[model samples]
Target: MAPSTTLYPRATLKKIVKAHSNRPLTKNVDILVFLNYTLFLQELMKEASIKSKQSGERGISARSVRRVREHCLRKFKG
Candidate 1:
């Protein structure tokens, strides 16, 4: 299998977390940690759905994407 490429670099993620630190609420902090990943996945699903539509295939599901997003948020919550 090929190596996985990182969508967000460590420094970028650190910056996001740092920026959100100003708020310091539990919900905001949780969003700060998982925002990048959630956004990435959402974009990925959007693209995949578009491509699938072009190819006349079934597209990605919004419900499934939400479930995945919630799972990540829960996993990253401290």
Candidate 2:
């Protein structure tokens, strides 16, 4: 199997979670949260790109992202 590479800094994720949570987290928890966050961004970008294309835009815009944000959230809802 190939090695896994992180797109964002693990330290930054740790800091963000640390600030919000009162309890300490294990390293695996940090990795899981990082992975989920990355996946959320990927899904959001894909939806935004499709929205932009439908509107004849060359790139994803903030408006496109805003339009699809709720859809993405609903799809990812647990």
Please give, for residues 1-78, the per-residue lDDT of candidate 1 as tens digits.
787685446566566766867754443444455676677666657665665566566756665455355555564455
Give me the candidate number with maximum lDDT.
Answer: 2
- What's the lDDT for all of these models? 0.59, 0.87
User: For residue 64, what is the lDDT in candidate 1?
Assistant: 46
- Model 1 poorest ten-residue lDDT run: 23-32
Task: Provide TM-scores for the models.
Answer: 0.37, 0.66
Clashing pairs in 1: none
What lDDT tens digits, residue by residue, belong to model 2 across residues 1-78?
Answer: 776686677888788888888778887777788667788899999999999999999999999999999999887765
lDDT of 1 at 26: 49
- Name model 1 segments beyond 4 Å from true: 1-31, 61-78
